[model samples]
Target: MSSRSYDIAVIGAGVIGAAIAAQLSRYAVRVVWFEAAHDVAEGASKANSAIACTGFDMAPGSLESDLILQTNPQWENICRALDVPLRRIGALSLAFDDGDSDSLRNLLNQAREAGIEAELIAGDALRREARTAAPSAIEALHVPREGIIDPIRLTVGLAKLAVLNGVELRCSTPVTGFRHHPSGAISHVVTPTGATAVGAVVNAAGVNADLITDAAVAEPFTMWPRKGQFLLLDRAVGHLVPKIMCTAPTPHTRGIYAVPTTNRTVLVGPTAVDGDDRGDKTTDGDTLDAVWARAERLLPEGVERRHVTKTFSGLRPASDRTYRIEVSAKVPNLVHAAGIRSTGVSAAPGVASYVADLIGAEVMELPVKSSVRESIPVIPRLAEIDTDVAATAFTARPGAAPDEHPIVVCACEHVTAAEIAAECRGPVPATSLDGVRKRTRATAGRCQGAYCSVGVSFILSAATGDQPGEVRHGEPGSHWETPVR
Candidate 1:
């Protein structure tokens, strides 16, 4: 076996792993990233509520609180450098009753303890700011730093930047096992292709992190899957809520939240359900109906189920306690980043920096590269293009190869065939329909790929040299065999 060695190897290409890999690439180190799935961010990263959380509601003195507080400011810098869409649109945790209002005051104190600056807005001021709030809500806590982000774009951007900096990313490569070298503190990771040796390994595998570490070293903790399902409203209702609207915090979950996405679509929901099932379960009609009922109570005239485009679910890797980020005491070179639940997306950049610091302290002579490329290539949006720019682009690349510029395939989201093609041909290219959907947003709109699935499948077939019948949805081993009528 021709063995490959690296300074660091990160298992799982979720948001946290991608962020860590991207940050590690800024230093002069050989980095290898492994994903069990066909693409990056296909797991918990793709399915969350997509909120850039401020540390306002995290448990005080917890790892999540620390990371959330540190990452909030770091996001602005990272988003700007990477061209990831992040809006500091703020949030409102509305209280509908007097008891809830009292709870809000308590939360304010907790927020202060967590180092989040927030204020309680009441009466007309609260009404004026968030007009869609239920009339019953007499007060609200306005967390000014809370924001919304495109999680997929952020993760993809980080992975792409890491790739440009010479980090080798291997998708469809699941690490089945690992062996510790007897002489040195190195590990030989076994993948589907072959084994690769590395000086150190970071287990950031979201829900499956514990399983990855179990075979080699004793896991420090365990992770439970907390499923959160979300409902996506059409763009027509996007203007009704200006900021991320939410309910008073609860002990089990964050409560239902209404958020306006960067793409001008409003989203609501994420009813938390605890389970061991890792697959994205079908959105139950009953669950969605309950969510909408709550949403109507929150926004009154703002929510309409008729405008509902899609519903999806994501699993959060909740632990018995708080998030765990530390090197294993049993294994010297192994680091475990597990139990990263809801706040992982917002806390990812800070987590990356923190992990880098930990890894750096152990290695004797690791040097930061003076000339590592910090900037990410910009992805031009078709919706953002003006008439003149569109004309110029069309002229530059004619319609005969119409997929070169922008051929609007998904009319609901304005996703172009070119964008799908580009994502399919990327460095760590998309291998399934859901992968394309996450990368280019081809199937995530009002129609949910009902009208455009065939076209997207054809595009995938053409791009990957696969037959039309061979193109599957996001999950591996599943194929789109049914011919489109």
Candidate 2:
């Protein structure tokens, strides 16, 4: 097999890795990103409660707290340039009981200590802000900086931008092992395909980060998987809550959150269950029942379960109850970015810069590349286009770009067919149905792909030259095509 070399190799193409790759691409260095799966951000990055955290709830001085606060504004800038959907609608942590209300006050103090701008809104003002709140709720902590982001689009944008900046992204390329030279530099990374030499390596494999490091270099670190499950509500219930809503934090987990995504849909749940089982995508009946009960307690006008569109789960890598991000002293060329849980989406960009600094200090001698471009192509938004303006343009030229006219592919989310087609063929093209779903939200609607799966499969097959039967769903080996009775 032919060998390849790079100044740096980043394992795991999740949001953290993609962000790091994007940052590293700014310099004159050969950077290679490896993903065990067929697509990037297929792991925890895609699954979380897609909230842009404001660092208010985090442990005041933790690395996560610092990174999240730092990355929030950076994400705004990045998403603007990439056309990734982001809304600064703000957040409210409601308090039903006096205990919860006191907790909010404590969190406000913590937010202040963490340098987060937060205020305690009480009584009628809090009631008016979130009309759906439980009548028992006397107050809330209003975190004005908290927002919602499209997690998948954000990760894809970062990866695409990194590729455009000259980062080599190889999917379906899982690193199996590594060989270190006597000088303490990792000389080669062994993958299923073959070995590739690199000067330094980053471990950002999420739930499997520890496994990857143990197998690759026998690095000692433990990663416990914490599962978070979420339920997507139809757009019909989108008006129930305007801004992202949450409950006061408990000792074990941050209680369920209700967030209205950029696409007019409401999301709820994310019950933090114990253990490392990542396979539980099927929403637990008990969990859903509990979530509904909690929603009623938090929002008296509470959402209906009948309005639920889809349910999914994500596993967070937890280690020693803290985010592990540091260069391995035992393994000189290896950098570990493990134990990044729920806040990962918000902390990704800052984590990238931090990792880039580590790479600059320890790895290859490199300079800033003059040829590296500073910007990436932004995805067009239907919501941003004025209907009257579009009509005038279309009237002038009836058949302009076929893509200009929106053909609704996912009725629940209003995603267009043109958007799906573009996502399937654009930079860092999606290869599977899930990849397309992540990139374009084609099959992530209320029907949960029951209605649009077939059509999207046809579109994906037509784009990738794959047979409809071969077009899989959520992951590879999970085919979506079967004749309906």
Candidate 3:
């Protein structure tokens, strides 16, 4: 029923897809972003061990390593332009035993080959650096390039900037299949809502990417769901670990790590469990217990279960082979950017660069825009803004602050009424409570939606002009089970 067409279509709205769409918007070509979820970053992009690694741990010369190294230094500019929070807090890998000591040396050598400056410290230096590390720790590998980032904010900011640059974003639109032109190149992408014919397509559909390729292309990789469970500790104890704390990797796992988040909290665990069902993001009782135990072992004093604000899990698109980032040889005009594994967030910019190059060469002379808007206006969070800036923001609208007027909603995170309303109607709008949390950190505090859910629901109702019960949580048929519109 839709008559619109695009020169290029991105199939996913995760970090990779959003970055690709944003980068492509630099040109004049028509680019549209599609997401099956109700909002961007509802997949692995929203949850995971959100480390912006420097690729020091990756296999040298692999696709993931190359991309990471190439894009690592660019994050400062990217995050600044996109208005996402990122910091070079670095990481410290502790060696508690002989095997870990050996792995530490190996990692140091690998870091050298990967062009990352690394140092191994022991004795008083190690003790001083890793105050919370296990007492058995002998030495620690410190890599200064690895940092932490807000993954959801990065994804949403990219999607917003892409939309600002004239890229169409379609949430709740699931691509059913791909119809090809006579030349064996993809022509039309069929979705539940409608079909879109495009000159080129990029397959960045996360775990569902293999299914999206269809019978036209034989995928080079097989993707299995690798579940990683995590525990988010409150910000009160976040300062105990100044750098990312971790143990060495095992045969299948990346080991447990406790990293400081951008929001002044700590994220630990992420036990890797391989499974058949891609939709299985549920955490097991035994797995979470082991994860916390491992985290405590790494951090001797501060880590506590009572401080845990949330326990969640994410599914990484795991594969046996290295990351696949190439144009499909089987399907013309289709680029394959799947099986990025745990490194997708760190390597997204590099992935975008490659996809842009491929689309530039393949598209039938898509016109380049004369000018492109690359930056998005920063949304000032009340919790993070300076006193003067907060005053200025509130002065523009006197009722903007919770203290000024009793329009307060999320008291835990100091989110006010005007803020929630703006997020619900932003460029990349929030459709549900969780969406608002991702955009504004309203219900993401210690209360965990306990203190703010009703007020947030009321604000959402008012914002959308829907009844209180009609406002869904994240999507239609969400766990809220509210009546559908």
Candidate 4:
């Protein structure tokens, strides 16, 4: 096997790793990013709650809290730079009884103590703000800072920036083990494709982070998949729930809630179940039914079954104890950013900054680039364009080329041929059907690819120079073929 060398090796291409790579891009360093999956954000980063939290309910002195608190206020600027969509529609945690009301009060105090702007509302005011809330909800803790984001785009955006800034991205390359130097620090990252010598290693490998950590040193903790299932409602129901409607947290789990996505769909659920399988994304009717029932308690005006467009699941990297964000005790060159659970979306920026600093202070000292490309041009998403204005129709944003092709490929989401082609031919281009979907939302609309898959397949085929049959829906072997019913 051929060997290579780099200043740093990031072992996972999830949000955290991608963000770390992006942060590192600001400096002049040789960095290599690795992903076991076929693409970035294929793991938990793709299928998350998508809530950009304000750390309102987090423990005041914890690292998670501190990072989230620091990162929360910077989302507007970060999302803008990345061209990711963000909506600050706010969140409401409802109360059904006096006990629940008291919990809200305590949470309010916690929020204030953490410097998060929050308020407690009752009766008429709560009802006025949350029109779809259950009639039984007598009180609520309103956190206006809570919002939703396009998680997939956020991950891809970071990755794109990293690639543009010269970080080498290796998807479908899984790190099998590690090699050590004379001092017992890691010297190389072993992978199936090849082994690359490195100065430092970052184990940001999500649910499989524990396994990655164990490969480098003795396991400090174990990781299990904390499964969360969600039901996506039709975009037509988006107006009915404009705000994030949440329920009081239970000792074991944060109960079901309803959130509005940037795609204009209503998301309801996330039934938390701990398991051993890292690859289990299976969702069941019974668990989803229970989830819907719980969500109904928060949103009284029920979403019709017809509007339930899709049900999916994601696994959070749950650990036996607190989050591990320090250098490995034995493997001095390896850093652990594992055991991050549901709040990764909210805490990614902070984690990225902290890890970069740790690398600079502990692993290596690198000089900043004289010129840093801190932002990239936003891709012209046809859906976000003001097509209604005939005078300004088809005019691309600044730094983007004009859209000459007016042909709409995905009618459900207004995804145009140009948009699909652009994503398929970017710096970190889409190589599969799902990749295009994540970047352009082509197959994520009302029909959920039923109406647009063929069109997307053909466009993706044309863009990547792959045959129609060669264009897989996801990773290798996922061919563009219909199932035998």
Candidate number of the best TM-score: 4
lDDT of each: 0.82, 0.79, 0.83, 0.86
Candidate 4 lDDT, 109-167, residue by residue in tens: 89999999999988788888888656678889999989899999999999999999999
lDDT of 2 by residue, 1-485 (tens): 43668888898988888888888889988889999888998888888878888888887777888888788778667887667888888898988778887788889889899888898988778877788655676788888888889888888988988999889999888888888888766788888788888888888888778887786664577777777777788887787787788888877667878888887787787877658665544567787778867766554364677888787778777776457888887778888888888788999988988888877777556688878766677555444467886454324235744443466667765566667777888879988888888887777776777788776787788778889878877556887676858
Cα-based TM-score, every candidate: 0.94, 0.94, 0.94, 0.96
* Residue 373 lDDT, candidate 1, scale 0-100: 85
Better by TM-score, candidate 4 or 2: 4
Residue clash pairs of candidate 3: 28-369
Rank order (by TM-score, best first): 4, 3, 1, 2
Question: Going through the candidates in order, what is the number of backbone clashes in each?
Answer: 0, 0, 1, 0
Question: What TM-score quantifies how close candidate 3 is to the native fold?
Answer: 0.94
In the order shown, the candidates' Cα RMSDs to the true structure are 2.1, 2.3, 2.7, 2.6
Error of 2 at 70 (Å): 1.4
Best prediction by lDDT: 4
Lowest lDDT sum, 10 consecutive residues, model 3, at 397-406
Identify the superior model by TM-score, candidate 1 or candidate 4.
4
